[model samples]
Target: MRDLYEVLQIGREASAEEIKKAYRKLARRFHPDVNPHDPEAERKFREIQEAYAVLSDDDKRSQYDRFGTVDEGESAARQAHARWAGGRSRVNVSFGGFGGFPDLGDLFGDLFRGGGPVSQAPETPAEAAVELDFVDAMRGTAVVVALRREVECEACRGSGHTSEKVCGRCRGSGRLIHTDRVRVRIPAGVADGDRVRAAVRTTPGGEVAVAVKVRPHPFFERRGDDIHTTVPISFAEAYLGAEIEVGTIWGPVRAKIPPGTQSGQRFRLRGKGVRSVRTGIPGDHFYAVQIAVPRVVTPGGRDLVRRVGELYGVDPRSGLPLGLT
Candidate 1:
C-alpha cells in the first residue's frame, strides 16, 4: 500500500491545511465525473479517498505514523476488552502481551506429546454489517446489531470436564455460543467499508466490529467529503440572472444563477457539504448548471427565440476548426 502522505502528494510532516489543499486539488483533477470512462483516474481517486480517510483523522493518522496502519476498529476493540477484563471478567484474552498466552511452538509441541490439556484458543472477533442511508452516514447515528459470541461454560468453569467426566453443559468444548444485541455508534462522514467497534457485555473480553455500508443517493453523489449534483435551470433562468433553490445534503439553499450561465458550468457552495467526522470541518458542495430547453415551441415563442438569437452577432461555434489537429 502507498503511504497516505505519498498518496496525497504531501510530506509526512505536512500540516492539516496543506494536506487538505493537496487532497482537494488532486480530487478535482482526478474526479470520476471529470474523467469519466478512465479507470486509472477512478483508481487514483479511490486511493485519494482512502488516504484522506485515515490521514485526516488525528487518531488514525497517529496510528498510521507509528504502525503503518489505521486499524482503529481493532484498537478500539482491544481497549474495550481491556476495560471489560478489569471488571468482573475472570478470563482475559490478551492480543500482544508477554502474559497473554504460551509460546505457539511449545503449545503445539505439548499438544502432540499429550503432556496435558491444551488451552482453548481466544474467540475470534465477531462481525456485524450495518446499512445506512447516505444522509445518515453523513450525520452519524447509533444502531443495534445482533452478535453471536462464544462464552466460557459456567458448569465446568471453562475446563471442559467436571470430576474427571466431560461436562454435559458445553459438550466438552468448555465454550457456549450465545447471541446478544449490541449497539454501536457510527461516526459521521464514514464511507462504505468503515468499521466501528462495540463491546460484548455477555462475553469476557469480547467485541463486535460493525462494518458500514452506505446506500447511494438518488441525486446527491459523494466524492470524499464533498457532495456533487447537477441542477437544471430553465432557459429564462439561464438567460436572466435569478436566485434558484439548489438541493443539498442538508436541504435546499438559495443559489444564484448568473445571467448567461452556460450548461455544464459548475458552482461551489462553501461549507455546505459533509462535515468531517474527524476534524469537524465542513466540505464544499459543487453543482453543475444544466440549461433545460422547452420541448414544444409556439409560433410566437419561435419568433421570440429568433429575436433572442439576433442578440448573438456571431455564431457560437465560429471559432471551431473543421480539420483535426
Candidate 2:
C-alpha cells in the first residue's frame, strides 16, 4: 500500500487547503466516469479517496505520522502490554497499576488465541468495504465479496463439544478464522454511504460488517430521487426552441428547450428520474441548459449575431443591484 501522503500527492507538511486541492484535482482526473473501462484509473481513484479520508482527518493524520499505518495503535498497545507483562517494560505504562497490575496478557489470552473477548461490551464485528459501479448501485445487482472473519468451528457448531466430548478439530474452541466469499444483493436506488448487512457465522460471537461504496457518475448526480445533469446547447438551438435528447439511467429521452432560453436555465422531465425504493414513484430528471457559443465565428455568422443583438436591445442583467462588482 502506498503512503497516505504519497497517495494524495502531498508533502507531509502540506496545508489542509493544499491537501484538499490535490484530492479534488486527482479525483476529477481519475474518476471512473472520466476514465471508464480503465481498471488502473478506477484503482487510483479509490486510492485517492482512501488517502483523502485519512489525511483529511486530524486524528487519523496524527496517528499515521506516529505510526507507519493508521490502525497500528491497537497492535502497538498490545505489544506494549506484552512487554510489561514480561517485566521488561522499556516504556513507562500505567493502566490501573496498583498492586501487581492485572495480567493483561493472561486477561487477553483468549482474544489472542481467537477464543473471543471476555468482556460484556459487545464485540465489534470486523468491517470490509465493497465498491460498486454507479449503474450497478442504481439497479440492484449481486456481488461476491471475500472477507476474512472469525467463524464458529464446523465440527463443534459453536458448542465446543460433540456428544459430551470435546471436538478434536476445534479442540473445544468454537471459533476460528474463516475466509468467506458471500454474494450480497444490492438494493435499487441505494445511494452512497449505504450499508447492506450480510449475516454470516464468521465469528462465534459476532458478525462481519460490509460497507458499500458507490463510484461517482461522470455526467449525472442524484439528490433524493432527482437526477441532475448539465447539457450544453448551441446558441441557435437556445434562441430557436429545439427538442434535444437527454441521457437518463433508463435510456435517452427527448427534452424540449423553450425559445429564448437563457444560459444556466434548468429543464425538468417529470417521472424520468430514479425510482423510489419505498413508494416506487419515480422522481423528475433535471438538466441545466448551458448555451455553447462558438469561439471562432465566420464573417457572415458574426454579422448576423451583431444584428440579432441589436434587434433584441435588452440588457439581461439590468435588474441587478447597483454597483455590483
In terms of TM-score, the best-performing candidate is: 1
Model 2 residue 225 CA deviation in Å: 1.9
- The list of candidate 1 runs beyond 4 A from truth reads 1-125, 153-174, 199-207, 321-323
For residues 10-61, write the lDDT of model 1, one tens digit per residue: 9999899888778766765455543445688777876776677677778888
* Residue pairs of candidate 1 with colliding backbone atoms: none
For candidate 2, the per-residue lDDT at 147 reads: 74
**Model 2 lDDT per residue over 88-107, tens place:** 24212222121222222222
Cα misplacement distance, residue 312 of candidate 1 (Å)? 3.0
Compared with the true structure, model 1 gives a TM-score of: 0.60
lDDT of 2: 0.67
Give the CA lDDT, 0 to 100, for residue 240 in model 2: 91
Worst 10 residues of 1 by lDDT: 100-109
